[model samples]
Target: MTTTPRFKSDAFEAIHSAASGLHRSGVVGKQTMREFDALCLAEAPHFDAKSIAAIRKAAKVSQPVFAKYLNTSTSTVQKWESGAKQPSGIAARLLQVVKKHGLDVLV
Candidate 1:
């Protein structure tokens, strides 16, 4: 899964390029690259009920299973899908990851 953020500025772009080179040269470790990638992440998008349900469908998993991957409860997934609640913080970011990379990334 790609954790790289879209380059919005030349500075960040250059930084990422340099870091990537370092990683490729073994000056940076996999764990460090992952940490850098996390720091490069953009703000998570807000998912409406329909969008949340669509993502869940795309993953081809039941609500309970999706919740398990997301480290949330089935009831929370239901609430999000039903528009009774919204996922914020890490939860929202995780949904974005699953939406972009697929459910297997979490596994």
Candidate 2:
């Protein structure tokens, strides 16, 4: 059998601490963490405009109400639902969150 290499927890902690220092020195804004999260969601395979719209409809919520819940505009929701437009970047990520968590996020 082939052996896998593993590092100790302290080594990982040290690397993390060094990266945090670089991040705090104007090398990286805390915003990058949020951006990275957005990227991950955007890269997630399951998100699509149709799925987002269907989720809202499935929840039996009106377009305006759903938009308000998502902190977006009614027209935007309509565009997404009708396939007249598509969400990109952070908007896509937010839709992914809404899909998984439901409208309770608004509350």
Candidate 3:
């Protein structure tokens, strides 16, 4: 019989404990866990076109301003926000970063 060794048992336990703390504190819940799983498994944001447009609208910025902040073109922003086109590659990455960090890079 052959035995295989698993790695970093202590580190895994520590991470699990931290996640449990987050769950206990209500910082993480079933919905959050599901979303996290989707993000990890699908490698994409959960937002759809309408949701992206709504987020842009809620940000209260014009397409040009939003595009500038995203380091993309105004036309591309219009396409994305209007659901005519989807952001991809670096554009998608920039959008994700901006969603998390706001327009801090613009300043």
Candidate 4:
């Protein structure tokens, strides 16, 4: 919470308000709920390759070690660094958490 958020407070507040209205309407289906859960899990900070690499380097971990910490493969880490692929789903969110809250969240 020490870091300033990327979003403006009013923008975030509006988004939350919309979500609250949706919930109040009781129109959220099971499929919608599942999708929402996925969104929550993968709410990435939108880091690019350089940023991703910086984070790993900052953690003082090699690619393989970072992969192990993420329960993924070094190849995936390489792909992220190379921009061959973007980290998605839970992995992206986890990285965001690490960036904001420190790497200890994985532990």
Candidate 5:
């Protein structure tokens, strides 16, 4: 039998809704890079080396182009793909957004 992830999804939505509410109010203010990193870490899907490579390839962008779009270095992107390093924090979030929303986030 197959099971549904209704409860887990509900929890994610609740946390996201609270974050949205804080943003709507003046309490949260604008998201700084650090805060954005934290939020993305909390909310975005985690990417493995294969996933990172797939995302870049799926976007039909070269490593350097993807690096430029992420404001990172081509060496870093290569490291991520080779699993010498992981895309944590901002890079991870950007990768997730790109996976979900496409390369439009670049333009």
Candidate 6:
């Protein structure tokens, strides 16, 4: 993330910061902090097979290596690239991060 995340507004950032402080001070529980974290996170955008392949290529990694970073199987990556299936949930979100911040961030 940057100084201010693109996903959240200034108000959300302020609230999140306060929630983070509360979390650190043990004033807020992990569950509440997790809710705050979810509010701050952007929903993963849908990517077509071409876009998925391009992102992988741009990272300069093979399917197996990319799969390793994403904690998924190489065949899953292949399925995504071939339009046989699509990435969802965590994998999709990780792809968004890789697309925006580069694959190095995940490492």
Best by lDDT: 6
Q: Which ranking of candidates, highest lDDT first?
A: 6, 1, 5, 4, 2, 3
Worst 10 residues of 1 by lDDT: 1-10
Better of 1 and 4 by TM-score: 1
lDDT tens digits by residue: candidate 3, 7-27: 245665455556657888999
Question: Candidate 5: misplaced stretches above 4 Å?
Answer: 1-44
**Model 2 superposed RMSD (Cα):** 11.1
Off by over 4 Å in 2: 1-47
The whole-model lDDT of each prediction reads 0.88, 0.68, 0.65, 0.76, 0.77, 0.89
CA deviation > 4 Å runs, candidate 1: 1-42
Clashes per prediction? Answer: 0, 0, 0, 0, 0, 0
Across residues 45-74, which tens digit of lDDT does each residue of candidate 1 receive?
799999999999998999999999999999
What would the TM-scores of all predictions be?
Answer: 0.62, 0.53, 0.50, 0.60, 0.60, 0.61
Q: Quote the positional error of residue 63 for candidate 1 in Å.
A: 0.3
Q: Report the lDDT tens digits of candidate 6 across residue range 1-107.
A: 43434456788878888888999999999999889989985565798899999999999999999999999999999999999998887788799999999999998
Off by over 4 Å in 4: 1-43
lDDT of 5: 0.77
lDDT preference between candidates 2 and 3, better one: 2
Query: Residue 90 CA error for candidate 4 (Å)?
Result: 0.4
Per-residue accuracy of model 5 over 25-106 as CA lDDT, tens digit each: 7666666433643553344357788999999999999999999999999999999999899887668878888998998876
Candidate 4: tens digits of C-alpha lDDT, residues 20-101: 4687788666577555445433244577999999999989889999999889999999999999889976798789887777
**Candidate 3, pairs of clashing residues:** none
